[model samples]
Target chain A: MEKPQFDLQQAISRSIQDLYEQGTITNSDRHELQAHLEDSAEGLITTGLSEEEAFLIAQKRLGRPELLNEEYAKVNHNLRTDKTWALLLAGFAAISTFIALISYSGSIYYYLLERFGLSNYTWPVVAFLCLQSTLFLFIALKKREVSNFLRDQVEMNPLRSIVFSFTLLALVKGMQIAVLRYLPKSFSYPASTIYGFQGDKLIEFATYVSLFCLFVSLLSIFFSLRSPTKGTWRAAFEKPSIAFLMLFGIGTACFAASTRSLSGLLPVPMHFTLFGLVYLMGAALISYYNENSKLHLFFFGIFGFCAELGVGVVADIDRAQRGIGQIYTPFFILSLIVGLMAGWYMGNMLRGKDAIPSR
Target chain B: MKEISKELMASSLAPIILLILRRQESYGYEIIQEIERLSGKKLAVAEGTLYPILKKMEAKEWIAATWKTGSTGKERRYYALTQKGHIELDSQYEQWNFLHDLINTLWKSPNLTYNRL
Candidate 1:
């Protein structure tokens, strides 16, 4: 007689959630509205109306969810702006945390592997890529759930997500350092000095850092499965990027500054890890953001991904081509024209709701 | 019964709500039902529009709400008029009466010409 039935309660709760997403109502407002509906339905039931009839009438009086959202949105003009800042912050935190873990962790792992007389990195790379693909698959399959969760975190508390991510990255980062004293070293990590890295050490450091960042990112997204976070390497692991030029600008800076600190890093070649990262990141962004996908975007994604992988391979051909545009330049800037159509298909497949709209 | 325009309902809701709260503390459902009964079911205020307005009036300190356990052991938010609300009701009453009288006068004498500044 007092509490509404579960079905009725759930319906009202959805309406309340819609209002919440609009940023207009608090939990107490939700309670007040729910109480009103329950009371109305209870009274109607007492008057010989069926339970469903009573629920419908109560819902009608409460107003439609769309209209309610609009009315609620009237008060919070900052709602969308706040959400954008939160998204960018979370994205930045995830990307940086991955970079840091990579800078240091691989060297630590390589030492452990060599001590055991195991020289293969093939298993780890395969395992890492598979885990990454699973994550991309999860985003596709759980698209509805993840998007809702994303909205809840981004809307409620953006900064908390950043703090939450840092904690996880820190945990993974901590694991590598704790093992450092026990492992045999083929290379020295500057840890503090930027000049500690050179030649083979730099290649090793950059390679592992790139590889580990990709691995951690996959792990991070996987953990993000249960989490609100994503995964990390570097002694320069100590510190930690943009839209278009901004991404390039930061990538160039990291390429130059971390050059020495990165000396002698990963067991797996750098190209493999970077290829995985580009595919996953591009896929994640495309699938998550694009609402109504045109099939052309799918083909475009494949083209773009291939070109991106091609560019990295082209650059690895230019380890001697180490500076800013130098990597992309020697690789033939044609790769850029070529990559525009690649990688985004996996994104479209992961779009979840409307994967491809057939005209 | 005549269907009241939402504009009139919106303007009149505050004074009516202030009066209802003055008589006794009541929750949203009861206050709305009371308004419907008083107006012979001619008015139907939306819960959507009503709550936000309640929030504004609550902010103005013309009303205060407290949670109480209703008969069925469920919590209900009951609202009461405050000192400022009595003043607001009086103000609204005067404003409405003046407008009411002016309209009555105009309707009674539709052809009168007046000076313009």
Candidate 2:
């Protein structure tokens, strides 16, 4: 007797897959049905029927596809509206950009520039932030819907998502630089005085500008966290520990550079060394906690700043008594200790009751 | 054999499925075969139609499904009635018996008369 090879299962699988692709049934239900269809086909094959005949009989017995799909839809809710919130996001971006372009040429730009003593360059920065705040307000109003849309509607490949995020960050940074470069001659007082043109008014002006930049950066990061694609933003930063470390490192480097330029103390090399040390500490903390919560990052930033202010007051006193040249050693050591303690505490609090194992 | 009315069959489907599962745990294919065998070919449940009923019952927590290897060395999904399902089956049985008795009594009633004129 010649035996027949069956392609019945393949045909059954293809039909089931068609239903799956059409969103008529979910993966689990499809598998169940496929198995049932195969079993029925096999049972008929065992009764001396050819593979083709058995497959046809099995499929016919399964009944109509439309009826099956209707029933599956009731249970699975497989079909859903294909609306993307990206459209809303894109519209906001386009409108904001158009408004900024118009404002750059119109009276509003000149009004802001004259009223705040802002140059043509700096006024755009303010305008840009205003536009960003409008978008943030929109996001806040529709956060839940936006979040759902992001999860369900947005199908992004990893590479595309990464490229989009990096481009967004670079664009923001470029705008900041453009604003900084276009400042008027009066805005140059901070840099000149910090490098020893030596006027109290110049120092105050520089301090105010620096303070404004610091505030803007903090606000930028805070708003980025609230974005619907926060996961992508978080991933770009690597881990929370590194983000905290990098922020602290950059802040320290800036402080060190400005102070070095101000008082001619502790040359450029030492500032680099200090940054290197903070970065290493950040890398070490990465080994401790691979993941960080937003709350943990928030507390770490707050505590790091508080520690700096506390230590800075003491360092200032020491500088008055012992001279600026002698203050770097103790100040650097104290800040490092304070940052480490804060980092450790925040990481522990997030993990909840799993304190560092006692030696 | 007369084909069962879709309306009557639809109404009776859940109770019939529950009764089959009551005897033993079974998968979709097995349950369908058992129904056909028990009815002596009078009742035929379309394979596509049974899944929706199973899904509904599972959602209501009247049944639970598990995957196990069948005799052919392939995995098959089996379904068994839950405690709630058993209670429901008992209730359905009582309701069906009452309806059956009522219909029988009405058919045999002395007052039941029809004028051909």
Candidate 3:
């Protein structure tokens, strides 16, 4: 027969652990409570009680784990408002929202657009177009105020800043989708046609031209509106244009070199153009928001991850619809490396003595 | 003797705990044990309820806490009375005494008489 012995310490520990598992008390609180409970158990044991009896009495005297946790949480209410919990809650909310959106897409979409007079595509198009107009206006009319605002107010925690920039891009993408899907007739732009060889060549040319034009126009606007300062032409190295050019050049070269292995997996030039545009925008946003080098690296890593995830999700959805399967692609690793180099070059440029470091 | 009512127990907890800390710095477990020893097990104070009250006092700067190794070789959070806490305990003691005296005076009378309003 087994001896009538019990692990009193383990019993107390397990009970206290239940509180932390329930998310009522934090780890520190759990540690403190455990020590206190151990002390209580020790006292009870010394008072001529058996280990099992002492453990039982001590546990009872401490009251229910749930109640104790509630009391502790009430005391540490401010500590309970940690950002990690907020992030977790936000993730849950996003998942639930996606489920709802997918489940009731037709009804929700119709109600939002028809009854509310806010067609997703039309509204996003008008809103973003207005935003673009306002941005250009601010650059042209109130250049100093706009520039000053960007310089002064853009500083934030690096992780938070990257999340904000990513969210902003996501919003822009949503608007773009709205315009394409719902208000395509509003614009007489030629529809994208993916054909065999010649059509792919046409797309490649168009993408390249669009990317170049977009970069040049944005850089010209930014430089023109920025406050006038005394510096040599070399000072231009600190500007976002230099970083964008470096990223574009390096990214394009890597894509060109890997074209043989990647051609079967993707339309190489098209993806290259898109990656260049996205990386340029992401780098500028990071520099504009934060002057931290490590954050630039982090931003690039996250950007690469988002790019890969976006491509995978799109491919999966297309495959599901067309009954086709996807081939394995390791091209994202190349994108990741390009993103890191881009961020590194950008960080060095911004931090270099040639440019006036705002942060 | 009857068990102390929760309302009365709650009203007296701060003053009792503060007075205990004023005498000597004490951790939660030791403090609870001291109270039990003083009350001869008649007044049962739940350890769970003690922590929130202690935290509230700490938040108010009436008590400050420090962690120290106990006799059992485990870290224990010991709380001591602040100057503000000392003053608060004195005032609460006065209130408790006054209430005690009034209750005693009322109970001492064999028969109580009241006029109808």
Please list, in the order the candidates appear, how each scores on TM-score for chain B only. 0.91, 0.89, 0.88
In candidate 1, stretches whose alpha carbon ends up further than 4 angstroms from where it belongs are: A1-6, A77-301, A304-359, B66-69, B109-117
Deviation of model 1 at A221, angstroms: 9.4
| Candidate with better TM-score, 2 vs 3 | 3
lDDT of 2 by residue, A1-359 (tens): 88756567678887776565455565577788899888899899999998899889888889888888887878876333222234344334434543433323223333344555554354456456555555554454444344433333323333344345446645654554465456543433233233322333223234433543544343443343234234232333345555565574455444433433333334645553553355334433432454543344443345444645667567777887876544454455455555455555555454434443211
lDDT of 1 by residue, A1-359 (tens): 69655576676666565555444555567688888888888788899987778888888888886776666565445666776677677767776766656555656545433454333454554456456555655554443356557656766777887778777777866765665555444532444213222323433443545544554345434433332211111111111111432342234323332433322354333433343444344333433445433343343344444544565567666765564332433232233223223435555555556433210
| DockQ rank order | 2, 3, 1
Model 1 collision count: 34
Worst 10 residues of 2 chain A by lDDT: A78-87
Docking class of 2: medium
Taken over the whole model, the C-alpha lDDT of each candidate is: 0.59, 0.59, 0.58
Q: Docking category for candidate 3?
A: medium
Q: How far is candidate 3 from the true structure (C-alpha RMSD, Å)?
A: 22.4
Q: How well is candidate 2 docked (DockQ)?
A: 0.55
lDDT digits (tens) for residues A220-327 of candidate 3:
335532322211123343333435445644544333333333244467555654454445444543454346545444534553455456765687678867877653
Proportion of true inter-chain contacts also present in candidate 1: 0.65
Q: What is the DockQ score, from 0 to 1, of model 1?
A: 0.48
Best by DockQ: 2
Clashes of each: 34, 0, 1
